[model samples]
Target: MIRSVTMARAVAAALLLLAGAVRADAGATFRAQFGDAFLDRYWALQPDAAIAVGYYRYAARIAVPDAAYRARRLAFLERSIAALRRLPEAGMDAAMRTDGAVLLSQLEQERWSLAEFREWQWNPSLYNVADAFALLLNTPYAPEAERLRTVSQRLTQVPAYYAAARAAIARPVREQVQLAMQQSQGTLDVFGEALERQLAGSALRADERARFLQRLRAARVAVEGYIAFLEALDQRLARDGGGRDFRIGRAAYERLFGYAIQTGVTPDALHARALQEKERLHERMAELADHLWPKYFPDQAPPPERVARIGQLIARLSDNHATPAGFYDEVQALIPRLEDCVRTHQLVDLDPSRPLAVRVTPPYQRGVAMASVNAPGPYDATAKTYFNVTPLDAFTPAQADSFLREYNHWLLQILVIHEAVPGHYVQLVYANKTPSRIKSVFGNGPMIEGWAVYSERMMLESGWDPSPEMELMYSKWLLRVVCNTLLDYGVHVRGMQEDEALRLLRDEAFQSETEARGKWRRAQLSYVQLASYFAGFSAIYDFRESLKQQLGERFDLKKFNDRFLSYGSAPVAVITPLIGAADVSR
Candidate 1:
């Protein structure tokens, strides 16, 4: 009996060794086949995206948004998905597995976008080439001569690019067509003066310079041609009163929410959560306002209604803001202070070597959000991360005052915390450090936005700018986050109109009238994006709290933060399990 048992054990051990060998071989094969070849093909199909991500080999290639190119892209996506699925799961380590999943999700989303959702069919603004051209001019990724040469090559394709765009667009959404006209007109600057400046600085031979100048003029004409096409479309739609509806409706929004968020929470559930969160925030804000009422009002009794009291207090606080002329300068000055807060608090280890620059938003990229972080590609980890703030330079005096009040001093600090320090900039710096290029490149939207939203609260909790007034303003700021989800879900899914949306923002959320109007316009122009801030923040904050409970006294804040960010910009759903397993094992 003992001899028989020993023989059986030996047989089992040998089988295990064979399985290990199979896994190792599978891993090697998968990497060898998919690593470089797949990326080269993928980047070739998406040259502008390649430029954005620091893949410079495709810098001069321009993708034509025509039916044939799209069909080819769809086929590529399907084949890649199939190829990824063929890889043995046992072969991949935790990081590799996560990367594989991230890449797969990205592929599936793109496929759905082309085959099912088909934004390319309806969204005229999707065809803008200015951002790519602007990147070539401004990114400093290559030397002036090399970048200018790329511009010259890319200009050759501009006419064909716009021709394809014009053909592809049919019965486009009215809001999107208007946006396309504005943006396309703005892009003429990049091709004209911007190109002229670059050409003036370039050492292109006399002949090359002449050809470059000629191409520049042609590119400008092509851009103007596209704008003219949009204007004609607009006029036709205006006369006929026929255009595609901006609302994506419930089905498309739900599907997109799944792909973009990946939080394992349904849009219905997230919407419900936002409603509950809004109520809780309103209650908290009211309490704080009540607490500070006597100080601010001195003699008058507080309003009996909850919103009225909160509104009164916020109105008083809004007065303490920068003038219109000082808004841009104020944002720039806040960056250093935010840097010091994170360092002093030891919130997370920051890499000062990674540069973050504050700059005005490029004209081609304006009309979306007021501020955004332009992070370097994972491939170019050391490049500058621009904090692009849309200046109020052209706003009328009244418009500027309303804008300044919306971004009052206390709220502006929270904005910087969200946009710059310990927010998008800090998280992206760490995302670039992550070894998985897939996770860094196919970054989860909710994860990126969530970390930024979370950073706002995190900084406040760490006692930066500790004051009752700051606390009150943060509650109001956080209400905006919650309202983003509510507003997006309302507009896209429930067919919410402008009047209702404006009231939700201006009344319930205490946003200024100008802010409310802007958000209403933004909501129409985009879908499933505003909710990202709330969905991401909730998942990340919940994960941290759950970890705190699990670890008890042993839970270290800095370690927890650093380790959480180490996973790159992956879905919080994926990172939570890895974090839990790692902590439990430790």
Candidate 2:
């Protein structure tokens, strides 16, 4: 029986590899291949992955791949990259050629990065594949059977995944234990959310309810068992060896950052840039703030009392302005207006078929007060875009006032512009419809983020706001972008302490204690991600000006945007060439 089971496992693994090998030579467009292989695989097992791939409906039924499956997937990636490299770029159009190169480069980088995952080193966080799946399953879009299948698959793999995790850790017992505890907490949060959904559903048939309950219980038991396994692993690792750290060394860290983010700059250089930008932005913000609130005080100076009073006023405004429906109404209303504004200004020719919507954040994933747009996948022509706003918790009087003050109406509008209209949503909608699927999938962050950040300034330049209040709000958000860049670099490269980081946030960005704390945690958790916003926006602005000069009267804003977004998402390195050499004619 044991031999037969082992043989079955071996055969299954072989079949998966064989399938991948055959698919590699199928001669499908890179978009179709990625959609069929990578997107489809994760769609049912990891909804967050699906969401990232622009498949919200199947998000609930997706599970993170098992260890064996991950291994096979890696092998398949290698095969696909090999096949892609052989494709002739000579026959392709400029867009296609650019896309192909970017895709190939991204594939190589992804493969190298994935090699670092010797075990389940990234399991506990909300960004993790598992958490993404858990959130998706709770959505109404997923069918029960598919959800069950995904759940069953995840449950069955838990033991083995835990075992692999135990074997891979090269750290001390305490660290392992801490990791396990965090994982357990995250898992419990997910399970609790799932159970709440099931219990609240009055539409469930008796049998369906029973099934959900049974599965929920089973999941709980499995999670507890995995936690126990981790505890045991931690004890063993500690006893066998003194607690050792398992962090990737500097070289590996550098390689991963470069390949994954497509930035050649060192962390140190990035950090220094962030610091300089931060100071510049803070100065700009101070000037703007002083100009905006001149009525409350006489002198054009930074008065401590005035600053404190302004903070109080902001808090009051935020409280008064916050709607229970959150930012959805305001965001939805602004989309069309901004679209019109952009068109009126000849900023970008909007695609009629481009999908865009404002959505409330998923219930299971609240607490984070950030908004973002989920871009469509390379091949998916259905550019279903979501401008997701984090929901406000049912707030106490004090909390409500505090929350409201920071997220005032002007700030909210700016956020809408940044997250929706001419920001991410507009950029991605065009990207999806772009001819090159490969470029869409492998598009660079700097271009995407940079374009969005650049929009903030463009809006102002186009006379969207002339009031000091509006200008201050704009500058404050810019300050955030600056702060994000600084903190990301500082945490990762400069080894800045948390206290220092908090001080910078408070003094420079004017972040509240609560906001500062959250930013501090986010900075520590994510590296070099924040820099993309400022760095990218700066590069994009420079490129746009250079393009305007080159194109002269031919440099239509709408046409430029339409063309820029049409290439899909790719690194600026590849994108810059496609835009052609800067024609100094403006």
What is the lDDT of every predicted structure here? 0.88, 0.62
Worst 10 residues of 2 by lDDT: 120-129
lDDT of 2: 0.62
Give the per-residue lDDT of model 1 (tens digit) for 269-313. Answer: 999999999999998898899899999999999989999999999
Name the runs in model 1 displaced over 4 angstroms.
Answer: 1-12, 581-586
Candidate 2's C-alpha runs over 4 A off are 1-67, 82-93, 117-119, 126-213, 223-253, 263-269, 286-290, 299-333, 351-355, 367-369, 375-384, 394-400, 580-586
- Per-prediction backbone clash count: 0, 22
lDDT of 1: 0.88
Task: Report the number of the highest-TM-score candidate.
Answer: 1
